[model samples]
Target: MTNATTDAMTDATADAPLGRSAVFTILTTGYTGSTGPGVAATVSYVHDGDRHVIVDPGMVASRDRILGPLAELGLGPDDITDVVLSHHHPDNTMNVGLFGRARVHDHKAIYENDQWTDRDAEGHELTPSLRLIRTPGHSREDITLLAGTTEGTIAFVGDLWWRPNGPVDDPVSPDRVTLRTSRLRVLAAADVIVPGHGGPFKADETAPV
Candidate 1:
């Protein structure tokens, strides 16, 4: 089950005036197996005005898992304007080439074609309703994408918590303490969370602290 956390970032969208709506859909729900090699990245689609964003289009059972959902939403790869990678792990980046025409956003900067423009990710606004914030933990370069959707703020956090029923202590995090701190920060800002390897869930008391 999912949980609900306090809303500590209502002001984040104060500047996002009315009528500007950002909507999102979970294209694929990822999973990790206890044995064997089964795994996939949870992928998401976000639309804010003219921007069509694909988040974490990583390893899937098949590319159709990502594309089929987009097609159902009336969008194609060429229609995607941006792609956001929460971190650089192959599971979170392997399918990046699918959107060759889109600009890519990582923890560091925006990349498009052959140009890699470097910039800090903290509070970087992709649109008036979506932004990026540094939340390094599972990896020193990890970042979270915060989207102000009609349902409230949703955070696409990579590996911070693999799922709602989290691996309370991240097994691969370089700094457990830092991961916990980042978790708290994300819990504060997000009303809903789309974890790296699972379906989206509400942020609440059950969140790892």
Candidate 2:
């Protein structure tokens, strides 16, 4: 139940012991080739024993940065069991196809696919331990993945808000009320919050108003 920041895969491996599922945040700087806002994005994955689940594989532009780090950790796309998309936003789900054997799961409202289905108002459990809660606001299909890891409940919130610029908001959401309520639920539920952009933070310090 320790938390630490690492820039290299080597450092993370040395610091984390086996059997203790660790969350690794792979930061991929946003595009800046004169077409988009260039907002930086993050790719997170949970390393649980031999099983790895990727949350928000990030955009295709970050293919190497994301895959390279996984390879260094002795994991490839084939090793990933689940590709959980917090939402269908390009920043969060564009690279999902890269994981050949991984099953892609997302809010069914986003797409009518068999791989995943929409949950009830009470939400649904993807596994005996992991729960996928539908928390729309940032997007109609927005959802949060809650997993009880060694570090406590880690919530992978896709585009809930941008945190790098000091408590920044999404700036543009379809429904403000729904978004507000969603944020509150996540803040109350998670001990560690991993946003769609920026690094992970303690839920208390970044509580939503």
Candidate 3:
């Protein structure tokens, strides 16, 4: 893995191709203040051949923050084929309905229309380039989405680090030990990480242990 400074990492991987044709874009970078009244979920978009995926389309200052970028890419809500939630937290799932045509993937199963298909997310591949891996930390059901980009593996880890530097200790994590284990697992496999409440960053020694 090439050790890159955070800025260089983001610039390097932003347009990196996934597998042969997959690509991802951060629709909106999120933020959480020390306290009251300021929080937003970092949303992302992934496109791999037939799959038009939206990752963590949650709370934002406004819906336009999500849609505007999609429009720029020539997409609308109806164009999305899948929606993957890192976990079930409302902040990470509230805007899912915007893409009612999409099949939703969570830690447990796939939901589309009225059909609910039960399956473990671990090792589940939405495509050859994009897949899911169970990494419970911020929440017991949390899962990370991995995309095989040319730059390396990019992981969309929901709240796993909160931001690149991390909280060091997740104030809300149910299991600190498990969270640490998961963090190491992600760092081992991913070259870049798109955290739940922040922008993308390189996964390197600076990642919280």
Candidate 1: worst-modelled 10 consecutive residues by lDDT? 1-10
Displacement of residue 57 (Cα, Å) in model 1 is 0.6
> Which residue segments of model 2 deviate by more than 4 Å?
1-35, 109-122, 164-169
lDDT of 2 by residue, 1-209 (tens): 12221122223222112222445545353332222566545777775544477888776455787888888888788888777787777767778777878767777632223544444523555454466777787788887877666777777777785552323345567877667667766766667777777667787744553
C-alpha positional error of residue 31 in candidate 2 after TM-score superposition, expressed in Å: 9.1
Per lDDT, what order, best first? 3, 1, 2
Give the per-residue lDDT of model 3 (tens digit) for 53-76: 999998899999999999999999
lDDT of 1 by residue, 1-209 (tens): 12322232333334222333789999999988531388899999988988999999988999999999999998889999999999988888889999999999998889999999999988889888888888889899998988887777888998888887888877788998778767877876778999999988887777766
Model 1, position 82, has a per-residue lDDT of 96
Q: In model 3, how large is the Cα lDDT of residue 92?
A: 85
Clashes of 1: 4
Reference-based TM-score of each model? 0.90, 0.74, 0.90
User: What C-alpha lDDT, on a 0 to 100 scale, does residue 24 get in candidate 1?
Assistant: 92
